[model samples]
Target: MKLDRTAIEALLPHRAPILLPTEVEADPATRSGRALIRLDANARIFGALAQPALAHELLLEAAAQTFGIVIGACPPEGGAAAGAEGRHLLLGFDEVEFGPAALDGGAPFELEVALEQTSGPVHVARFSAEQGGAQVARGQLQVFNG
Candidate 1:
């Protein structure tokens, strides 16, 4: 399924500034997804730090939101409205690597996320981000759904 900003807003709890991706494509059956984020000077991250590079925390949040979209699109059996009523928590991160900084120049970036495993309300996903054909970051996110 393809999700726009409105759909993303409906699915995610995050609002403007914090909300990252402009669009997303998710395959619920395969539990895989991709998202596109365009960062510009107006982005909150830029305003907060006034740095030329996108912060690592923002990248991580973007990955998390992308995964959230995937899960939101595919609600489990008897699960509530995806993330509507559920609480998604970041359990931890594994083997996270931050590559070259992403400059705030209205450049677009892509994020890919794949489900690694699921145990109860906990879901593990591998994610990576790329900008200008170069890797920006990668990590495994352990998320808990409740």
Candidate 2:
């Protein structure tokens, strides 16, 4: 499923100044998705610097939120939606690496995430981030969707 910004707002509990993922191409069945975050010089996370850039750590946030989309959009077997109202939390990261942004000055950041494993409320996912088609970060994330 593809989600535009407005649909994202309805499903995600985030607003500007911190909202990531301007768009999403998510599939619960596939347990994977692409999340895109586009920024301009005036974007809040980067402050008022002449050129804006999202800090490396925030890329992890994008991964987490994108992962949430997959987990949250699924229909529960006999209950509420897997993507139902719940707390999505970051638990840990592994083999994560960061490289310099390919496009500076607040360009678009895209994250491709695939769910790796899950046990009850805990989930593991691997993600890679790219800007201008160049990888900026890659890692595995452990999260809690409780």
Candidate 3:
């Protein structure tokens, strides 16, 4: 069965994480689907201004547990949504840490996080945060499906 945006959203447990549609236009010349997603690392939407630690929580090693949210987007038409059904494997945070926030800066701080496909019981991925091209914090998370 194919999954649409609504169905996918329902399956996802993360309530407020930012979600960006991963879509590509079909090529008229070759008539290819062009559905494969080429995500620009800079396009990710950070947590809202309402919550201060929300964004930081995503970068923490324990973030997957601290806050719930899905990490990646399925194909344009939609593929098997990535997430768990009930619980996830925990990747405790130890060395990851975010720098202090600036009062005048637009973004509290910029972060670079990555999620990799895993075959474990939990949804696992790698994450990092940086400022002025300097690595400020980094960690891994295991998002629960339920």
RMSD for all candidates, in order, please: 2.7, 2.8, 9.9
What is candidate 3's CA lDDT for residue 131? 46
Estimate the TM-score for candidate 3.
0.39
Clashing pairs in 2: 72-83
- TM-score of every candidate: 0.83, 0.82, 0.39
Per TM-score, the best of the predicted structures is 1
Model 1, TM vs. native? 0.83
Q: lDDT per residue, candidate 2, 32-132, as tens digits?
A: 89988664522465456322344665677778777876666655346576666486788988999987744464678889999888788888999999888
Per-residue lDDT tens digits for candidate 3, residues 85-105, read 344445454455555643222
Best by lDDT: 1
